[model samples]
Target: MKGLFLDAVDELAAVFRHVARPGDPPMDVIERGEIRPEELPGLIAGYDFILDDHTALPTEAMRACAGLKHVIFLGTGARSYMNPEELADLGITVHTIKGYGDTAVAEHTIALMWAAARGLACMDAGMREGMWLRTEGVELTGKTIGLLGFGGIAAEVARIASGSGMRVLAWNRSPKAAPGVTFVDLDTLLAESHVLSVHLLLNDETRGFLSAERLAKLRPGAILVNTARAALVDKTAMLDALRSGHLRHAALDVFLTEPLPAGHVLTTLPNVTLSAHSAFRTPEASEKLLRMALDIACGL
Candidate 1:
């Protein structure tokens, strides 16, 4: 079977080569800077499988690629790129990798939280510009952290927060328990937590899960952190709350629109810290991601 690695960004390609085995189907890497939906059909013309990192394979494009049978998405949030159900209807099996970068992402979440709480990024930027800005930050000790979803990433966050002397409370779609963590209802988690971290997967039910009404339930001046898909939170609502000072700050690694268009409102806010959706990035996580993708591709 012929396979194409569409949008194989650098560094990751090196890791992919290391894990790819001999005797496997020939794989081609297209080193383009970006792939848009309109370019999908021509780019994937006759490949039996495509390994996509962040490119979109819209249903219309998938229908045009007559030979494409499998999509080995490099991460778990394949829905953000292509709808699995829609592709499945076209006889294309969408495979996603999970548990490959849980610890890496969790560590990043903690890093963002600390950065937001301490104004680390702003301070660093100011210092680089010859200005020394020291902003007072809230202490995390004895504070309550709310986990929006209790999955692998959230579990890891719970572990780290607990070790740091912060009380952890989580609200999953279903019940879950972990040492030194309490499982609470959504309202309780919102009303009580001083810091709220979102880790839910994006789906119909979870899309816009943190709406304006729900966000208002959070304690005034609460900190918000999301390493999950940005669509989970209503962007307008979040901006309003931040502008009103209802939310103390936000540490965001993902945005509804990636590469977040220049001059986006979120960029202008002082209380918001932005990361380029790189929370899951690390040497260790990169290796695991490549190995897992290759395993899935080879299995097919």
Candidate 2:
């Protein structure tokens, strides 16, 4: 069946076109920048499938898309943008792609970890203001790093960090076995890790998973790197912890709000470094992602 590539940004649309080999399902591209929740039904009209990226499809609005049957979301965090079960009840199956950007994201995670450790962002900001900033950096070798969730991305991060001479630790809801990575309980991971990287998926149970109480348990002055969903942690508590210096730094790629509003509190904090949710934006990853999305669309 043919599909609509909704919210196709210029770069991603280019990737889709480059990867369009013969025999894939026909898909129309709409290079619309940012769609509101209220505008979804009309935009999605008459398509048998939708290739979605960064749009919230509220059930009420999606109920009006008469011919829609499938949504091939470009990333694994489909839950953050739409409720799969609710959409399924309306005969629209939400499908997400994973493992497409494991390396890209893992490399970004490592870079963020290094940047935070040495106050690289702070120094860069100072440099931009005509100041000669010589900031002391963190020596990552021999330091302990904790992975809050173990998945492909985390595994890649573990591989890179372990090779670079850091002690690696991981805690997952399900049991996992990775070479050179120590598996530990939540409290033990919290108490012992020098750098904690969050990789949990967002859902009802995982929403606000890192609460104030749990944040309190973390070893004070530890660095936090969250490439996962921002809803997984309590924003206010995280801000408080940063202000109080309980958290040495936070390198974030995801946020409670996308394009995190100007003058947001996180922006005001010097200890926090932000990326516009771009951990998975490399060309290799984008090519793989579109190829997978096309595969899902063809299957429908």
Candidate 3:
């Protein structure tokens, strides 16, 4: 079977070339930024499967791509780009890679948490603009941090936060246990945490999980951090909380919209810190991600 690595941006094509084995399935790497849903049918013609990085493959458009049997998504958040169930009904199995960037993403989550706690971004931006801004910072040495979900990434985050002398509390949809991490009910997690870091995966049940009602439960002046899916929180409620000083600050690595539009309300918020959904971006993670994708293609 043949394969195509679709949407290999940010030098991923080079990484694919470096990790690909001689005996692996023959795959073509397309070094482009993004491909529209309408382009999928044509671009995937004659290819048995495609390795999608970040493309929108609407079910209607994918239905036209005859004989395309599989989609090897480069990341676990495949639902953000396509409806896997809809494609499954059309005989296209969508496969997602996980654990490839767990450590990389966890480290980034810690970075954002610290940055928000200390107002590092605001100070840096102010200094660059010829102003010396010094804001009061939150000391996390003995603070409580809540993890919304328990998973591979959250596990790594727990280790780092625990080692830094912060108390770790976690609430998962199901039961979980970790050394030095307390498993608590959602209500307890929300009310007691000084820093709330979201790690829940997005789905029908988890989308908007942190609604206005839930946001109201959080301790006032608590810092919010999300390196997981953006849809997990109510963006409107989050903005309102920030504006009213209900939340001390929010450090976000993911968003409701990618490449958040210019003049976006988030850019104007003094209490917001934004990263380009790049928590999982690192040389080590990139190499491991491509190697894992290639392994999936070989099995296909």
Per-model root-mean-square deviation over C-alphas: 1.1, 1.0, 0.7
Off by over 4 Å in 1: none
Candidate 1 weakest lDDT stretch, 10 residues: 10-19
lDDT of 2 by residue, 203-245 (tens): 8999999999988889898999999999999999999999999
By TM-score, the candidates rank as 3, 2, 1
| CA lDDT for candidate 3 | 0.94
Worst 10 residues of 2 by lDDT: 37-46
lDDT of 1 by residue, 1-300 (tens): 899999878577878787788967789998775888788888898899988888878898778888899999999999998889999999999999999999999999999999999998888888999998998998999999999999999999999999999999999998788888899999999999999999999999999999999999999999999999999999899999999999999999998888899999988898999999999999899899888887777778
Tell me each candidate's TM-score.
0.97, 0.98, 0.99
The most accurate candidate by lDDT is 3
Candidate 1: clashing pairs of residues: none
Instruction: Estimate candidate 1's alpha-carbon lDDT, on a 0 to 1 scale.
Output: 0.91
Residue-pair clashes per prediction, in order, are 0, 0, 0
Question: What tens digits encode model 3's per-residue C-alpha lDDT throughout 1-300?
Answer: 999888899888888898889989998878888688788888999999999988889989999999899999999999999999999999999999999999999999999999999999999999999999998998999999999999999999999999999999999999989899999999999999999999999999999999999999999999999999999999999999999999999999998888799999999998999999999989899999989988888888
